[model samples]
Target: MSELTQLSPQPLWQIFAKICSIPHPSYHEEALAAHILHWAQEKGLHAERDAVGNVLLRKPATPGYEKRQPVVLQAHLDMVPQKNSDTIHDFATDPIQPYVDADWVKARGTTLGADNGIGMASALAVLADDSVQHGPLEVLLTMTEETGMAGAFGLQPGWLQAEILINTDSEEEGEIYMGCAGGVDFKTILPLEREAVPAGYQPLKLTIKGLKGGHSGADIHLGLANANKLLARFLSLHGQKLDIRLLDLNGGTLRNAIPREAFATLALPQENAESLHALAQEYLAVIKAELAAVEKKLAIQIEPATSDAQALTKGCGDRFIALLNAMPNGVIRMSDDVKGVVETSLNVGVVSTEADRAHIRCLIRSLIDSGKEDVVGTLSALGRLAGAETIAKGSYPGWKPDANSPVMHIVRETYQKLFNKTPNIQVIHAGLECGLFKKPYPQMDMVSIGPTITGPHSPDEQVHIKSVGQYWILLTALLKAIPEKN
Candidate 1:
């Protein structure tokens, strides 16, 4: 065990350390689910797995609180598997090496998985600690939340018997999230026609790197650069002048993450090679100035490239670049109801050119259904104009904030009494499972809270040590404060 297991909340950190030793990347959570099931059973609690692999555990209330309402602790079991290109760790086999850095705990060369891992650990700690006073408790560890709300979507009616659910997935320590935005996946595919490269053409590689990419939902309002869009912009601005013929294009990975790197290779007449390099440098300067504040380390590199002597036909190349450049990205609209919430946004998260086609995938999020449909319609129109096929998938609903929740009142009062300050109760622009859970369990009252986690879904992910202690205190206190059943 590393020093993280020795942190102030030993029980919580200890379980988190064990979690780091297991590989639980999205869509591959069976092992971790089994591990948690075994642990819960060893503690003498009733444990079982749902058809979709969600783990459910039940524990009786403390001696005096058995008559109070039964509360549910909810968290996802999977983590986003992300790492730097050069990191030598494998999410399928290797354990995340976590260590302490001042007031935070971070992983070595990979995402720390603290986003939901810390939440899971806190739940386990609560279950194992017999001293904490609480009513009957149910733990729900859902699967594949990062990729989609698969577990929540497949959750059967009556699977959980609780009136109040405390989701341990929110990132900020002193804030509580009562609602979140809904989202859908959008993909565009452009057929490619390849031909032998012109006899006098030379291949040039263009790369955009070092941008501070982050969660497309959580960080969209931060003004961070999207590398995929940047690369497409560069190609559109200079391709015609350089007589560029695209060979290959690739960038980004997950639909929920803002792209940090992009690369494209193209063929141009030998006479225009020098001009291409000069224009690249000029455009780099402009882009740098535009993203100077948030993306200080943004970089653009141009170099000679050698590959198969084939390139996209001129017509296809022009259409592809034009469509990519025209797609809307980043924040689309801000909420008029909430002071600092993003209402609608989209991220061109992944782009790739394959043997017969070039593809682009985007994640569109909005608080209103009409806003989501508007963005989808716009993309569909662009795809038609570009002669590309478009498809939308993995759509999920948004959690609407409740202004009259008794559980919210209990949590707020508990937090104020503990910290001597009011917590920030707000809605988030990101997706959460609470929305999907509401479909089957319409009567369930829900709120999300967690320790302070930053740079989630990226290699820079970390959890503040001090906040873990505070989060634990607040959760346990909230449990004790659940009012007696009427």
Candidate 2:
């Protein structure tokens, strides 16, 4: 209830809390952007915005550090729009209610947006720190990064002049991320038909809920259950036997977040109602036991539908389930070079059945362009086989790691001096804007690092409060270690 700035010195939490108080969900960031610009002006720094609403703040080098090369600190300004079905928070315009739970800061019943808000907070924190020695600095806060990398894509040529970019977008705290996967979002549409309700039948709805869903890219290889897949499996096993006619189906919402819950409606023989209820309970136990560790809270529900006379069209129900069962989800391949890293993956993230056609959104990710294309090809082929029209959008390239990067070396050395251990350097399976930023600044050297964050892309997302202090320590040290140009 009290204002965010009332909490001081802990600038990371303060700035993050301030950010939370504003509604900056993808494409609706006017008030949040104005907040950012107002803050930048208060610091007496020059802030500029491009036509697409991306903000850039420039700070001249400290007196003795002017000779060093300028560095750009980058983070997306917008967060992914996601919330628990029961939560009343609105993305278009509502404050995020966050609480500290021992080690991490989390929001109530919704995503905390730590994915890049922490990055933005860290940048603003650094800009505000008077003691941290550094050369010239430029902070570029982009808009609408989660829905797509449109904020990065919308940048006109020469918007950022720095050749070195520090992206604070990765989730893990200690590891230094040098490269990341490229990805694309594709959707398929299928025709729908209607039929009269069957006689001597009762309408019923089945649901799968309470899974601990996460970022599809970061959590794909874990073999977590997909709600749509579980629903289809249930239908495949008991549908025909129960004389069930599935009418409506839906699951997931975002292309990047794992589907947490799904439900379907169907008409079934009234005589089998008790048997169906028993089956739902049995299946809940079986699935909970199967995914006990990964998805401890998984649940299943079976309830009578509001209307017993309504039934799904025979044509639409058959094709919809068939399409879901055939669609690919989860890790497609393991990295050949990075040992444990996922090389390629696909997620059938969102599906909606409409009156005329079904719309399905699939996300494909890979560390290489060729591998990404192969996954896309496989998805397209499957969609074609299912008689669905497919559309691919939101494509972004991979950012290849540079082992010999000067800024990377500086960060590594500074980290060792501060923490007394070499930082783990690796390529991530998720997408980062550095991939597209490189297309413009071909010579740009980039690395992504961030405080520890967990359950990103889901309502449980949080940031480690203590890690922010250490992250700031390492960041300032790296800035001081940068080499001065002749």
Candidate 3:
């Protein structure tokens, strides 16, 4: 029993501790799902799995609250798997190691998984605690929401009995999210032309690392650096002065996160190596000064590298660098409706070059469908010009803000009454399953609320302890205030 279990709202914290012991990365949630099933069974709750692999467990309304309208607590089962380049932990098999740091709990050198794990834990705690007052409650845990809304997409119409949906996926406690942005993933593969390296060419590795990468959508406007974009720019800058051949290039991991590190293996003349090394140092200083505030510890290095593969042909290398440099990244537009909110943005999340092929992955987010399409068109056109294959997938609609939501009104009033402070209600820039639920349960009023979580989709992720207790209080209070069905 760590101190985390001793926190206020112990039920939620204890269950969250258990959740951290299991690996539930996107597309690899079998073990976690099984744990959930077994937990529900032990409590004699009616739990079943939908065809889409979502877990739904029902707890009958508390004795006196039976007549209130049923409510569904929704959260995703999967968490994004991200770690520092040197961390040895595996997302598929190894459990997340969480530690208390002052007011927040963070995982060591890796993403904390608190993004949805804490939300899921809150739902499970409600089912386990018998003394809680609540109307009929259904907990719906979806699958692969981090990689894509797989479970939400396969959700069958009329499957849920709830007339009201309370999504627990939103971060930042006290703020209620009534809507969110839509997103599209673009995967591109540019075929490479290879040729023999020039005589007496030595191999050197160019590295750009230690950038403070964050969520592609939520943190896109923070001016944090992207490793892929930086690597491409650095190489392109010096590529003109010297004819460098790329032996191998790779950077980033998931399309939803800003890349923190990137490196490339190059074949260059021994005499030209010193020039490249000097340039790398120069670029490092420039980058350090550029991102001093947001990205501390930025590092660039050039060291001896080992690679026997042939280097990319000069023309192919030029085209590859050009494509990446030209790709639209960062905030494209700001919301005219919501002050200081980003309306459209793109992240060049991952880029790599194999023996004969170069691949790049990008994520675009927009509050409106048209804005998303515009970026898609620009990427597709860039692909055509580069003679690369571009595939777009996993697109979900954006949730439009609804100011008249009954649940939102109740939540706002309840928060002010409880804490004597008004809560901020805004549409999030990140994608949420709320948009998908509106399809099946069109009439179901929804609102999202959760504890304060920072650095989601990245290794710096953490949850605030005090905010979690406050969130738990607000959630239970909302369930007790459910209105009776007419």
**Per-model C-alpha lDDT, please?**
0.91, 0.84, 0.90
> For this target, which candidate reaches the highest lDDT against the unseen true structure?
1
Q: Which has the higher TM-score value, candidate number 1 or candidate number 2?
A: 1
Where is model 3 more than 4 Å wrong at Cα? none
Model 2 C-alpha lDDT per residue in residues 1-486, reported as the tens digit of each score: 243344333776688888898988888888989998999999999999998889999888888998888889999988877788789988888888888777677889999988888889889888988787889889999988888888888887787877678999988767899999999988889877767777887888888998888898888888788898888888877777777787778899888989999988878889988888888888888888898879987889887677533356765676678778877789888989888999999888887876667788889999988887887787788778778888888889988988898888888888988999998998999899999998778888888888888889899888787787788888778877777864
What TM-score does candidate 1 reach?
0.98
- What tens-digit string does per-residue lDDT give for candidate 1 at 1-486? 669767978999999999999998998888999899989888899999888888999999999999889999999999988888778988988889999999989999888889799999989899999988999999999999988788998998898988899999999999989999999999999999999999999998889988778888889999999999999998999899889999999999898988888999989999998988898889999989888899988888888899984899999899999999999999999999888999999999999989899999999999988889999999999999999999988889999999898888888888999999999998999898999999999999999999998988888899999999999999999999898888
Winner of 1 and 2 under lDDT: 1
Tens-place lDDT digits, model 3, residues 1-486:
386788878999898888888888998998999999998998899989999899999999999888899999999999999999899998999988999989999998999988898899999999888877999999999999988799998898878999999999988887999989999999999999998888898888988898878888778999999999999999899986777888888999999999999998888888898898788888888988998889988999788888878888889988999999899899999999887888999999998878789989998999999999999999999999999999999889998889899889989998998999999998888888998888887898999999999899999999999999999999988888889988
The full ranking of all candidates by TM-score, starting with the best, is 3, 1, 2
Give per-model TM-scores. Answer: 0.98, 0.96, 0.98
Order of all candidates by lDDT, from best down to worst?
1, 3, 2
Quote the positional error of residue 434 for candidate 3 in Å.
0.6
Could you tell me the C-alpha RMSD of candidate 2 in Å? Answer: 1.8
| Candidate 1 deviant stretches above 4 angstroms | none
